[model samples]
Target: MIETIVFDVGETLTRDDCYWNLWADWLGIPRHTLSALVGAVVAQGLDNAEALRLVRPGIDLAAEYHAREAAGRGECLDESDLYDDVHPGLSALQQLGVRVVIAGNQTGRVGELLRGLDLPADVIVTSAEWGVAKPQPEFFHRVLEVAQAAPDETLYVGDHPANDIFPAKAAGLRAAHIRRGPWGHLWADAPEVVAAADWRIDSLTQLVDVVRA
Candidate 1:
């Protein structure tokens, strides 16, 4: 039985349109171009960071990130950014005595923004704080530590197969593939994702029933 559900931020609990659109504006590229490049990179199994390189070769990403922050253009998460089902779904899980954790490959600042939303989750953490990103076994090791539950009893939910499902399953945690975001919808029916994901869901509310099962 799953006692804890750990969710990925982007495309799982929230939409990432704002994040990428900001980057597109910062880089002076059309949102459609950046978006298409993002899809291409993802389809090629390349990290989305590659999109930046594709836009401006030899660019310093960290410098640009700090510049954006300095310009007061940093990421800001609000209620509108959250999925409609996120609140009720997570709240229902909490009511069911199931632990809900929001863990994802996000910045420390994103964690802060998420906290500002006051969502119904037991814990909210990010890769920046942990110093370990997903698709890394050690990251899941840290997740299990944060979860305080056995791998078999924990469920890892996310849209990205490589960064979320694969590593979580390799770490012995059950994985749920949610078909939403670009990568999600693109690979929703892929044989690998289908085989690797213990449960394939379309929305967050399904998680309430998922944990019950």
Candidate 2:
């Protein structure tokens, strides 16, 4: 039985409009354009960051990130930014004595943002803090270490098949393909992605029963 449930942040627990819109402003592009970029990137099976590079050459991502942080942007999010299912789902898991962890590919500032919102997570970690990002095996290993739980006892849920499901399973943790976000809904029919998951969920609320099972 799974004793811990690890979740991805963007598009899993939180909607990314705030973060992406900030990037849109920084890039001097209309928000709708950035939205199109995202859809194109996902449809082409390209990495989101790489898609940005393809669109704008010589863009210094680190410098832009620092500039944004220094200028007090993308630092906090409103409660409306989260999916409706997030709070109840996380609450249900906690009430079952299941450890709920947020381990996702995000910048160092994610911890601060989550704390500012006081999200319901037993532990929160990010790729920046771990010095690695998914779909790296080290990232998942670190999550398991942080949770003090074995891979077999962990259920990893995320919307991205490549970054979340594949890596978690490769690292020996059970993966749940949540079909609610860009990559999730777009690639739901992909044979390999479908095969990689141990479970599939339509929403976070579904996870309450899955974890209990």
RMSD of each: 0.9, 1.4
lDDT of 2: 0.85
Weakest lDDT window of 10 consecutive positions for candidate 2: 47-56
Query: Model 1: per-residue lDDT, tens digit, 1-213?
Result: 988999999999999889999999999999999999999998898888999899999999999999999999988789999989999999998999988899999999999999889899999999999999998898999999878899999999999999999999999999999998988898899999999999999988888788777
For candidate 1, the 10 contiguous residues with the lowest summed lDDT are: 204-213
Instruction: Quote the lDDT for 106 in model 1.
Output: 93
Q: Give the C-alpha miss distance for residue 212 in model 1, angstroms.
A: 2.0
- Candidate 2 structure quality by residue, lDDT tens digits, 22-97: 8888778888888888889989988877656755788898887888888877455678889998888898889989
lDDT of each: 0.92, 0.85
